[model samples]
Target: MKRNEGSFEFVVGLNRYWLKWFGLWPHCDRFSSHRLFVTLLMAISLLIPMTACLFESNDFADHIEILSKLIPIIMVTIKLFILRVKRNYLRLLVEEVARDWKNFGQLELYEKDVMMRYAKLGRLINIICIVFLFLVQLGRLDMRFEQSEEIGYSAYQALWYDLSPGTARFFIILILRSRKPFNITAGKFYIMSMSSFMNILKTSGAYLSVLKAIK
Candidate 1:
């Protein structure tokens, strides 16, 4: 019994030592930030079902289905945001260290930089998951719009009439997901796509200018 008590005391002491030195207390102030994220994620999840129920018509069923998918998406978005925040914090920490102790050499800086990069990668993964889900929702919207117009209705109608709040929620989910790079290749591709689009616009503008000058 005495030996067991001693072991328990040793464990408790070890925990105290680590908590004090590592600043790893369970109820620490830093946990408040994590808690806020959890709250927001839960709120988004709750909103999914509540918002879906509001759409009573069959036309809005697809919207609700897409909105339902957004619960997982918003949760993933919060995770991505948290990782981005961590990366930014690490960056700020490195900057602050550089300002305070110019002697804080590359080793310490590199360590933080590596951590920031890894956090960013995690954020990117979450973003990819979100984007994949968003694209799926978009495909659904496109199909819905196409079906509406195919049966003899207007095309490219006002979003107010064509898209419901549920659909809006799905679009928001897509935006959240697309806010990061899913992988190195995907990131590169996204950058290339943006560059290509810009180049196309520039060429188009130049062509228009030449035509105007000729006229």
Candidate 2:
């Protein structure tokens, strides 16, 4: 953990409460109450919807058709498990974010405004997840990172050609980095993007329909 890991709290404060509750904060733990809460949460989510099955009439052939409730829990579990296994990497990512926030004053005015806009968008997405499920927020972050392409174009339009060679070189470097596109991934396997999310939604829906038809 970096010395300034705790510092983002001043800048971010209450916005991090949800992250800490989910155990997505950078700090590690030997015994996490958050994990216990998550386990209990998952268990409850898996069980509560099943109560609907209890009301089903015995006359129906698929009388125990609890698949509807089960599907969301299963998807959520897979997503959470992936996150749990990759917690170390996620911690590093979080630390880097805190470090960046620590250096926030170092950025140019326009740069800071651009970053704050993205941060607000990310915050909005996270709020939506709390109101629903966690999937949508991940997609929105991926989509927002793709906006680096705009940064590159904006840099090009900054009249860098009229500047001294040394300053122009810095703009060139910025453009080069922006061209690479920042992204988050699920380990090395999946590029977390809006298109990937769309595919996941399609697959989930198709599977749900198929399961319903089988009943």
Candidate 3:
């Protein structure tokens, strides 16, 4: 396949499939405005729970719970920043991969195998993480439900009133927080792709190793 075709397939067709399924797609568009909006939304989502925990929750356990939630959000935020900075490099790398796969004769099979393995592994890891996060959210919700029943409160009341089931806020928090996991997954995939590409170049006796020497 041509470089553009291959790059397009790998990006829009493959990588984004799971992203969309997980509701973590970054909503790639021609304009930077949409990305900025999404980033703002994610920031607000993270801040809301954190603000609640700091000023509203009096219990130490509440602090722990909020901190736990913050961990993933922080991770995702860092990854998104990394991706935004490296966006051009990532695109060029994809095109390079396509060119090498198509033009390199002896290394074609090895290149294809390595790329496929890493891609599959990355996708698998993303799926597992997504599923695990979902389960954790579900468990938090179940606990919230039980607490709400005991306290004779509704879900919304539990959240609004800072009751035992206030963790129910996690639902809305996670919906807006989707950017974190999406960016994290995309970041991981990008890193793996770059690593695999470099390894292939080194193994194939390419001068690309010079780039590594500088780093």
Candidate 4:
């Protein structure tokens, strides 16, 4: 059923008034399509270490691994929430910028700035992932050297090596898509960015614990 615009506006104003009184107004909108994509990417990244837990038969180890995965998952979820909030903020920002949009050059300049920022971020993530992959491959080589006398690295080890880089790449894409801040970082408490290496580390640690248990 179609509702009257006047009624709809009245309801919105009422809600806004209440929300403001409750200190809940102006909440960010983090549920946009871009944010959803980022969340999925982060999830896939966390799944990398999960493959290690698969080889273990010990329930206790599996449980620990499960616990480890929780942190990154939660962090990613929070990031999604923040992204939603940021989207709401963007609406306000666009409104502010719109008045200045009368000049075609200014609008084009803003678009150019946005594209440049994203492009740079993309390059940075690609470089980081490349480095991460190289290190992982080196570790795999070392693992194989030790296992040469045996089966030449167990299936679990091989899978971990394979999956980790892919997971890292997924995170890179996630960061790219999420519009997460790259330059700015905080102490251990937070990355000061939507998605972060710290989050990946926390999640990877949990999965690693699980893998260690299996081993």
* After superposition, candidate 2 runs with Cα above 4 Å error: 1-7, 10-16, 22-24, 37-65, 132-215
lDDT of each: 0.52, 0.70, 0.58, 0.51
- Candidate 1 Cα deviation (angstroms), residue 24: 24
Q: For model 4, how does the per-residue alpha-carbon lDDT over 163-189 read when each residue is reduced to its tens digit? A: 677674654454354342223235656
TM-scores of the candidates in the order shown: 0.26, 0.44, 0.51, 0.25
Between candidates 1 and 2, the one scoring higher on lDDT is 2
Q: How would you encode candidate 1's per-residue C-alpha lDDT over 21-129 as one tens digit per residue?
A: 3333333366545655565667677766756665643667776776776666677556655644565564565455334333323347686466456545655666676
Q: Pick the candidate with the highest TM-score.
A: 3
| Regions more than 4 Å wrong, model 3 | 2-14, 17-27, 55-58, 101-111, 153-215
Task: Put down candidate 3 lDDT per residue, 104-198, tens digits, no spaces.
Answer: 34456777577667756766777687767766655565555445444432323445445344665665564444433321124555422334445
Report the Cα lDDT for residue 181, model 1. 27
Over 54-171, each residue of candidate 2 has an lDDT whose tens digit, in order, gives: 4564545454456644666677666666777777897787778877877777779897787678777776776776645556666567657868668899999999999999999999
- Highest lDDT model number: 2
Model 1 poorest 10 in a row by lDDT: 149-158
Error of 1 at 42 (Å): 16
Candidate 4 residue spans exceeding 4 A from truth:
1-60, 93-215
Ranking by TM-score: 3, 2, 1, 4
lDDT, residue 186, model 4? 51
